[model samples]
Target: MTTQAEKSQQALILFAHGARDPRWAEPLQRLQQIVSKQVSGDVLVHQAFLELMTPSLPELIAHLVQQQVAAVTVVPIFLGQGGHVRRDLPELITQLSADYPQVRFTLAPAIGEDEQVLKAIADVCIAQL
Candidate 1:
């Protein structure tokens, strides 16, 4: 059985590879807004950058810890499972797990790799054509 506090202590982090131009994050921000609205109750939906953007993963995790979030689901927005997703992210999650032993860290596959997402992209392309 989960307590109310425990129920409120879950978060979802949308992780993305940041770019030098802030405009690059606009789509991600919109995605965040969409996800945020879909989530009910106290569940948090946040976006963090791997580089060249504010509030990196570690920083966001620290803040979430402060907010007493007990679990985090990290969803990579990258199109492929490249070095950043396959290597660097796991290393970072391992370190964060060590640092915050109480918190459960879950790494989700890259959004673009999902069949539904791919279908959506194709649908858009088809519509444009």
Candidate 2:
């Protein structure tokens, strides 16, 4: 039986749509830093963009694979299940799976779909009033 410590390395990718302005990425970058610190190197956390940004999803995945990450969890940061999340992401995953059969990629629902997140947002909305 494989030991707990022998489990394959894993990574978390906070996938988001990019904007033309560089500042738009700052919040995600902050999240990446916070998560990395919280994990304390147990699992790597990364940020990647769909367009108008550097380090696209494919690029980040290739880089992580080179570092020998065995599995990856991609969390779409979009507010809803749009075509990009429903259609484009799956196509990208298919290609990535074919390219790197050794790596396992798990796609998560869009962040906005999480109940706890929605509750937090709602609370903050009322607090702002």
Candidate 3:
């Protein structure tokens, strides 16, 4: 069983494929903010991008490791299992795992794969028509 201290040492990383435009990161950052507030103080929520953005995955992981975060879950904020999500991400995770052997990094499915997100997207589409 996981104790409070164990949970406190865990972090959630909201992983996203970044765009060149700064504005592209606003929603993702906002999401990190929202999730951070909702989770227990034991957990830390962060946003990291695959490319064209600051705080790349490796960078964030390095910082978190220094902060003594024991475990991490990476939730890809992508809508589909594209190349980035399917291939690049796994490679990155592999390297990160090798680099930070002490930290546990788990990758969750891409956000769009969730039923809730699909339903919400459908609702928005239906409302728009």
lDDT by candidate, in order shown: 0.93, 0.91, 0.91
Q: lDDT of model 3 at residue 22? A: 96
Error of 2 at 27 (Å): 1.0
- Please, what are the lDDT tens digits per residue for candidate 2 over residues 1-129? 965456567999999999999999999999889889898465989999999997899999999887778999999998899999999998999999999999999999999899998998899999999
| Cα RMSD, each candidate | 2.4, 3.1, 3.2
- The collision pairs in model 3 are none
The candidates, ranked best first by TM-score, are 1, 3, 2
Q: Which candidate is the best by lDDT?
A: 1
For candidate 1, lDDT tens digit of each residue in 21-76? Answer: 99999999999999999997678999999999988999999999987899999999
Worst 10 residues of 2 by lDDT: 2-11
- Give the Cα error of residue 116 in candidate 1, in Å: 0.3
Off by over 4 Å in 2: 1-7
lDDT of 1 at 104: 97
Candidate with more favorable, higher TM-score: 1 or 3: 1
User: Residue 2 in candidate 2 has what lDDT?
Assistant: 62
Cα displacement (angstroms), candidate 3, residue 107, comes to: 0.3
| Cα-lDDT of candidate 1 | 0.93
